[model samples]
Target: MTARVGVVTFPGSLDDRDAARAVRIAGAEPVALWHDDADLKGVDAVVLPGGFSYGDYLRCGAIARFAPIMTELVPAAASGNLPVLGICNGFQILCESHLLPGALTRNRSLHFINRDQVLRIEAAGTAWTNRYTPGQEILVVLKSGEGNYVADPATLDELEATGRIVARYAGAAPNGSQRDIAGVANEHGNVVGLMPHPEHAVEALTGPSTDGLGFFTSLLAHLAEGSPLAGAPTG
Candidate 1:
């Protein structure tokens, strides 16, 4: 059966369509989910695409965190029955929603940075990253105003010790993210949030590289195994 991946569209979401198209290209059915809809329509997974939701008011994802759809998403994700990937502003929402730890602050330079960035995979255990080998390097697009990730040192230590730092900038940090982190996955690995826009790079013709397609394909493989959507690391 083809996996059904739901791409959410919040008020000012700019990449929902791109996310859906990437899902299709990955051989999954794209399901357009609305912010107001509580039901996920039995999707196998979900993607929170990047955008300036609520005009980035109060904070990038502050307002979108309370959207009705998140009511179900929160618990569903916690249950480990569904996989969730948040990109860019979507990453902001995930952090705000407490689905992941830490916060995305303004760039250290206080400017919106846009470019093709290289990322090193720190953990290949997550459902969305199994296609990569740990420590693998891949290129993806990174574009956002508030991209710096911050958390207490203790939390940062815990995340690193537990292999939760899923990805990190390959060379010089672009936005002052703690530890040069580019993305992270929750303990269960069902929820992942990344500062870069992977969906944007899934198409080679228009994007810098097709490396992002691995994320979508990895999820499908995980679901097909009838396992918990997350693939927590094992020492």
Candidate 2:
């Protein structure tokens, strides 16, 4: 059976379709999920695409964290029963929901940055990054105003010690993120929050490179291995 990955659509999400397309391109079935709906539709994994959710009011993803859909997504992902990949605003939501650590603050430059960024994969064992080799650099789109990731020094040390740091900006930190971090994963590697937009870099025709497709393909491989998420409802 083909792996089914759900791409969530929030009120102001702008990359849901692109994310779904990337899933399909990665040899998996793409399912649409809504922010107002709590059901996951039995998907083996979920993708929270980029964009300004709820107009990014209050905070980038503060409002979206309380969305009806997140009620289900949070627990499932937190318990390691589901695999979730959050990008850009979705990353903010993951942090806001407490599924991931750290908060996305304003850029050091205090400007909305939009460009192709290079990231060095620090942990390739995560559900979304398994296809990448450790230390491999991949180029993906980075576009956001509040993309600087910050966490308490103790938490940062723990994340680094446990190999939960998934990726870091190569060379210079575009947003001035501490330690040049770009992404991180939960303890079990089932939940990941990335500031860069991988979904936007999955195709050559429309993206900087096809390197981002690996994130989607990695989830398919994880499901094929009969992970716990493989038992999820497939309806």
Task: Please give the lDDT score for candidate 1.
Answer: 0.90
TM-score of 2: 0.95
**Tens-digit lDDT track of model 2 for 59-90:** 99999998889988899899987999999988
- Stretches of model 2 off by over 4 angstroms after superposition: 227-235
Output the number of the TM-score-best candidate: 1
Q: lDDT of each structure?
A: 0.90, 0.89
Deviation from native of the Cα of residue 148 in model 1, angstroms: 0.2
Note the residue pairs that clash in candidate 1. Answer: none
What's the TM-score of each model vs. the native? 0.97, 0.95
RMSD of each: 1.2, 4.0
The CA root-mean-square deviation of candidate 2, after full C-alpha superposition on the true structure, stands at 4.0
